[model samples]
Target: MTRRRLFVGLMVVALIVCMSTTLFGAASVRRYAYSASNPGGVWYTMCGGIVKLLQEKLPSNIRVDMIASGGSVLNTRRLASGEADLTMAYSTHLWECWNGEGIMKGRPNDNPRIMFEIYKSDHYFVTLANSGIKSMKDLEGKRVVLGPPGSGSSDNSRFTLRTLGINAIESELAFGDAAQALAEGKVHAMGMSGSPAAGLVEVAATRDIYIIPFTDEELDKIVSAGPFFSKGVMPANTYQGQTKDVPVFMFTVYQVASKNVPADDVYEMMKVCFSPEGKEYLGAVHPYWKTMKNDPELVKALGIPYHPGAERFWREQEQKK
Candidate 1:
């Protein structure tokens, strides 16, 4: 009789376990694709840090599969095609993609939603210190690598130079390759983005470099044309041979997601981004992230609508305040 009672109790427990599994299938691990820029870059570094934090804090159900990709332009395209759930992108790149301009011409990608704005990336005009190319006008008829063919720096350089009436003889080269070209005297100068950007750092290590400064009149001309560019400064000693603050024209960058991401997942993700642990980690990983925090104004730039999930999280935080 005791054996019979034990078997019945065991069966009841088994039945309870099955019922719980059915009710909590959402807890099952889910794999999601995340696209980041080239390995060792600002986007990849920040993406890696955030993904690591999420893996630790999020339920095992949310598994992020990250991929190294071509910077902002390609990342934005992937998000629009539903090929990726998350992407690292620049504000101006997507804005033009949405407006059917530049490389994304006529094929608008207006669907990706901002999860958070990360930092302002600036277009750095690098030349050999003794090159004597002090201004954009000096670039006219000179060899300049304006980022890789489809890169944000490439697009910005083309537009910026065009606006200033400096028609540089342009070449499309990756930042690292461009740096090599500059160091080897193959190119007169190159324009690329990011602070302490790896490519520039590599070149600065071997040769004396100078940052081409944008005069207030030059910056005013650029900013007057659109909201995409702003006047900013790269602090002194930011790079090798950089002795003082350099005036720069800047734009913002962001993490974008499909509007389809579950509201709860995004809410939890934002919490992790702002959590003391996450805040500490990202700032340590990248200099730009030193100022990372939630800001409603970050989303005010040109782009698609904010993720509803992101909106929900913001509302909850506001109430807490």
Candidate 2:
């Protein structure tokens, strides 16, 4: 409880320290800030990969600076507030922000526009194997990191917990911090969502960590709660452990852009994404991209209007093929 309270109290301090972030751009160039997640997570790495690609491929007049942020919910706020030009956010987070619900409830942000769906984030409820936390029901009364404050992690955690009738002592710690705490046995489980997520492989390398799969009953409760939730799976061998697939709740992670961004810049960005070489280039950046292609269905799934620039690029791609 001390570590949980301490981490909670540090929110103020973390905010102050996290206020400053790395930005890479030229003074004379047309630059935009992209909000992403912490170092250990996939979003951070994916954003970093795109940052390098944009810097190298886009015309010198444009620059994209990256901000390692809390996670999806915060990224949505940044986009809606004109603080960022583009970001990748969970589909549920985007849906909630657009309709004035979820974490940003009552303050509807109608500005978020979908670019494309990237991959699905499966919720992984991780606890030390010896803890005997074999399922979501086992989490009751235990200390858990319910994901970072204003993140999709926390958003999912709260709803799932409410549905399951379980309330673990929760803290909103970022991926890296929570992983550290878990390693020290400060928390019983760390709830997170990501593809090729952090901590799984690392922690499993030394200690035995078990991933608690969401039961069908829990998945039905989640999906019945809203259209945003879907069933997902963690393939066999995704992490070193028992070899069978695990059932999990799933949602889309997508690239989002604002209606305010200059259309030409957005078009150029989209064009580069599906360019002949880019099609092959992206798969190498993150293994998740292996399944993503220039598919119109990916955009349609988000259920939001697209930025004109992004729409034009996709339309052009369709016309060509």
Candidate 3:
């Protein structure tokens, strides 16, 4: 009877162990990697803010981490390779990568599916106020810094110059260094793309600055180059400047995910990001977030297919209306 009792006790312990494994294993954490641009850029900060929101609002078992990367072009490649679970990239690059055109020629990436439209990145072609470089036409035969190589800003700069038929002596530099070059008169103008970049603000703090505006005819020709380009206006006083409204070409920025990621996780992320609380938190993190809208129409306009999870979220939102 003692031996029988010992066997029964062992069975009971085994049962408990089975139950414990089932209970605890169900809540095991999942980690996802999010890729963004280099540190000190708006994309990196925006990714950090998003990861923080996901941490706060997602189920405790899910965690997201950020990876610093080389802007949009490289981020698209990372998404294609499954090296990044989530990434932020311009709509122009997304279209190019998916279609296997332009810089992404002959190597298509069909894995990236859009999560949402992040914001509009306006082009800022800044020069010293006293430089006498008043227009895009004036940039011809002059030295310019067109962001770092492979960056979205650089691509846009090249596209715009090509479309406008201007041949400027172009060099690639990081945004901060480009701003400093502009201030020190090393470059005639610096073409940057952002919603009033911090580097531009710093340069303006120390020297008189001017943002070269595009004429209506020039804006029309540039936007005609691609469906991704659109007309945008930089409001007066976006930077410390002797100000007036500035017409600029702009492109949409999108948050996309690898198709292999679980649909439910992306759905949950969308819910958290578009929630009133989440938007408020992100807007507080950067003024750019304030420009974000919950509208799925903008995402639909991008011509890229949405992730199944994101599509589900948007469909439900539409049903609620």
Candidate 4:
């Protein structure tokens, strides 16, 4: 009876202190700012999932906002300026931004925290069946529809093509606008990087277009060359005339944010994000959520320190293991 009373007294004291801290901390407002590449792309949709999850999990006073930007490079710039709390970034871009390569070009921003790996995006080198371009070598003289300037896919396509030794003239077309260019014969090939069933590929399917497969030698070279590279396949029957899976280069998509954000906020945000209740939310937000099921290994390869809040959430996940 004595011990029980002592335990109860300690619990009461702990609660009182917590309440006092809350009361004192009320003046310290927390505002979370997030950004994504396109206004209506997968990034915004997935961010909506995070927002809803965080809303239910965070303290009532915390504010969360999602903004739109041009692409990963722009998002990285915003993060560097401390303008965003969180954002979606390509793994390749993250590597480049960290190492000052590619579009980052000696302007690396190391002030970001890698929270988690979001998805694996596959590269698609698509063309009409009649275009007569059967391999990467065939694209040398072809007119290619690269993605919009400054978009993540555009950057990936450019670097990938250059690495593969293809030097086709690039047409600055967005994924949504590529079908018309292909149908008009203005371009012989279109380079895209996304999920196997991406909307752009669906559009191409309707027009009897399909992606070409990369050779095993090509896949091996990419994976051995960079931390960002991976192997992915577009399964058989995804696009018109595709009777077998198409091989392609792939890389992780990362959930990231500015390092200056408070650790506590980052923790709760990620807690809600990876919770069982958030699974359905993620699936509804993007089909790529299936890839997130392999998150443990993915997080291990995050290549940067997690935000304090995100680290706490990951620790809790580890406890469950």
Please name the candidate that would achieve the greatest lDDT relative to the true structure. Answer: 3
lDDT per residue for candidate 1 within 27-48, as digits (tens), equals: 5766668887664245657778
Minimum summed lDDT over a 10-residue window in model 4 is located at 36-45
Pick out the ten consecutive residues of candidate 3 with the lowest summed lDDT: 293-302
* Candidate 3 lDDT, 1-321, residue by residue in tens: 999999999999999999999888775877889887664356767778998899889998889988877678778888888899998888888888888887689988789998877788898688999999999999999998888766788888888899999999999887777888889999999887786676778888889999999999999999888667889899999889748999998888888999998999999999999899998999988778777654466656656788999999988988999
Worst 10 residues of 1 by lDDT: 36-45
Deviation of model 1 at 300, angstroms: 3.5
lDDT of 2: 0.79
Whole-model lDDT per candidate = 0.78, 0.79, 0.84, 0.72
Q: Model 2, range 164-252, lDDT digits (tens) per residue?
A: 88988988887778877887799999887875676556777778777788878888888889556788888878877747788888887
* Total clashing pairs in model 1: 0
Give one digit per residue, the lDDT tens place, for model 4 in 1-321.
999999999999999999999987876767777776553234545666776667666778777877767567667767766787788878777767776776678887787887777777777778887888888888897898777656776777777677777889887665556656776678888877675434455555567675878888877866776566888887787665678888988877788877888787777667667777776777777777645633655555655667677777777777989
Per-candidate clashes, comma-separated: 0, 0, 0, 1
Model 2 segments more than 4 A misplaced: 1-28, 294-301
Each candidate structure's TM-score, on Cα atoms with residue i matched to residue i, is 0.85, 0.87, 0.87, 0.80
In model 4, which regions exceed 4 Å deviation? 1-29, 39-44, 48-59, 293-302
